[model samples]
Target: MIVFDLECRRGQHRFEGWFRSSEDFARQEELGLLTCPNCGSADIGKALMAPHVGRKGNQMPVHAPSVPPPAAAPAPTTLPAPAPAAVAAPAVSSTPLPPEAMALMHKLARMQAEALKSSRFVGSSFADDARAMHYGEREAETIHGQTTIEEARELLDEGIAVAPLPFPVVPPEQAN
Candidate 1:
């Protein structure tokens, strides 16, 4: 017996059919007796054959045919869901504002101006004036002026009630 790989011209479905010889396949095809089992197509022809297997004494041997590789893979059927709600929030700063916070500092300097209108401009004499007021050598009054951190520290060490203003005050001579 001989086997032929046959394909349907209409649906291109391929399968194998047994015959007495290669001539038998040709004779069946010429007689229009060949049909595709998959799509019932009668327009059939011999499919391309792979390398033949070993033969017997004046006879042919049959072997299981190889399967064709897939033309395309199937699409995925499912998708993942959204995550849970237990995520932690991020932390932010908790420190006090600096002495140079722009608009707020400008507003604070204006408030200091109003407060100092009834006070005095001691210029760089801030440490001396503050000490004199602390010792009762001068009348106690609101004052704003320039002083280094060292001067502020000395005044504070001497038990003066001096507090560093939140903004630098421009001297009257430096005003625009």
Candidate 2:
């Protein structure tokens, strides 16, 4: 026996019925044998069955309570934001020399040491001795010593030839 969902046209009522075959159901339907139990209407036809679309994979049909369709969603909105100026930037100092510059300074220091191999060290009297040489009171010779930028500039302004040492020089007194 086969069961089918049947309906009556006069009352639009749905019901289930059993039959020996599809042909038996059709024959009975043709002979006005099917009737709605609730309405007793013989104007009966097979109800359109909802297509049995099986769930794919591990999915199951969710049996949720009926909820009214949400009202038309409000127009999309944007969040308020602070001005770009109000955002705090990362604190970074611009004064530090990069690794490449520091490496170059070290390389230049080595090169300067090599070039000053024959030069003499005059200790802290660099300014006075340099001035004396400029005035022809002392013999001119290659010399290197510690001097401030201001003192070097002063020497240069006085027409004295003074070039900065590219590296710190070891004082003769300090050399053991």
Candidate 3:
């Protein structure tokens, strides 16, 4: 599976999309299957990403200096209180979502829950089951299950309809 950082042209919203290959991504885009989860926009495109090139196998690993560095002076026993502005500022790692976005996410989660109510969990046999239904070997029924990206791509190639859930589903056996 390959993951691409995708952006919605309409809202400039960025999200990750996993595909079996570049061709699979192109096929989905051409078929208008790609959409922005945040804005519901169909104008999705790959966002610029930095390549993750690893070091050559023959390259030697860098080692730290064996000698310890000189010790620094001790910190003061007591420090001045932080300013009110600093205390009010949000942390770099914990940006809060806007109220509207939070509401939309909640609504989406509810919708997914409602849809899953009628769908049966087929576990890891999703591809086989879907193929069986599509080829008339089995009766048609709603099913949701875990399958690899390659399996999903194969199913799509075979004209079997399958889609990823917006939110991950806990398998019934694993659910609390």
Candidate 4:
């Protein structure tokens, strides 16, 4: 698999896209499948990125490690207690979104909120819930939750329909 930095011309939003090959990316772009997650724009293209070059096989180490003489241990101070777990803030982009992009984002967020009104938030049990529903072990209904990419792929391999949300969801418990 190869990763490419993609940018949306409409919003100037940058994101990564993974593909089997360069041809795969081109095919997706031609088919209008490539889109910006932030502004839902289809005007996407590869972004400028520095090439990654590896050292030659016969090249020696750039910096050799030096060993120092062992010293006596003399420190035994009281350690500070660990801080409570806290939710991390989302990463802010260095560049601000265009006005049109911001407007579109707001509209998309509102649309997602409306669509999720009747859907259930299953938290981390998303994969299990989806599998159960798929296997007829539970009643099938609209559900949204968290799951690892590997788990999602497994579900898809099992013929269960699943899709990723365009935006991150705030858990009901974490919502004010």
**Candidate whose TM-score is highest:** 3
Write model 4 residue lDDT over 33-124, tens digit each, in one string: 77777777788888898775779999976986686545675555788654221111234679989999999999999999898998999999
> Which window of ten consecutive residues has the lowest lDDT sum in model 3?
82-91
Tell me the spans in candidate 2 whose CA falls farther than 4 Å from its real position.
1-103
Better of 3 and 4 by lDDT: 3
* Count of clashes in candidate 4: 0
Over 33-137, each residue of candidate 1 has an lDDT whose tens digit, in order, gives: 777777776798877989676767888666768866576966567876532211012235587678666667779879877887887788999889888888899
Global CA lDDT of candidate 1, please?
0.75
Once model 1 is optimally superposed onto the true structure by TM-score, how far is the C-alpha of residue 89 displaced, in angstroms? 28
lDDT of 2 by residue, 1-176 (tens): 66667777897777666678899888877876666676777787777876445589898778989876577965458875531211012336689899999999989988998877878887778899899888999898888877788999999899888887666677778878
**Cα lDDT listed for each candidate:** 0.75, 0.75, 0.83, 0.83
User: lDDT rank, highest first?
Assistant: 3, 4, 1, 2
The candidate 4 region of ten consecutive residues with least summed lDDT is 82-91
Residue pairs clashing in model 3 are: none
TM-score versus the correct structure, for each prediction: 0.38, 0.39, 0.48, 0.46
Candidate 1 Cα outliers beyond 4 Å, as residue runs: 1-107
Over 1-176, each residue of candidate 3 has an lDDT whose tens digit, in order, gives: 77777888998877777778899888989988887777677898988987656789999988988866556855568997531211111236587899999999999999999999999999999999999999999999999999999999999998889999989999999999
Error of 4 at 27 (Å): 36
**Which is the winner by TM-score between candidate 2 and candidate 3?**
3
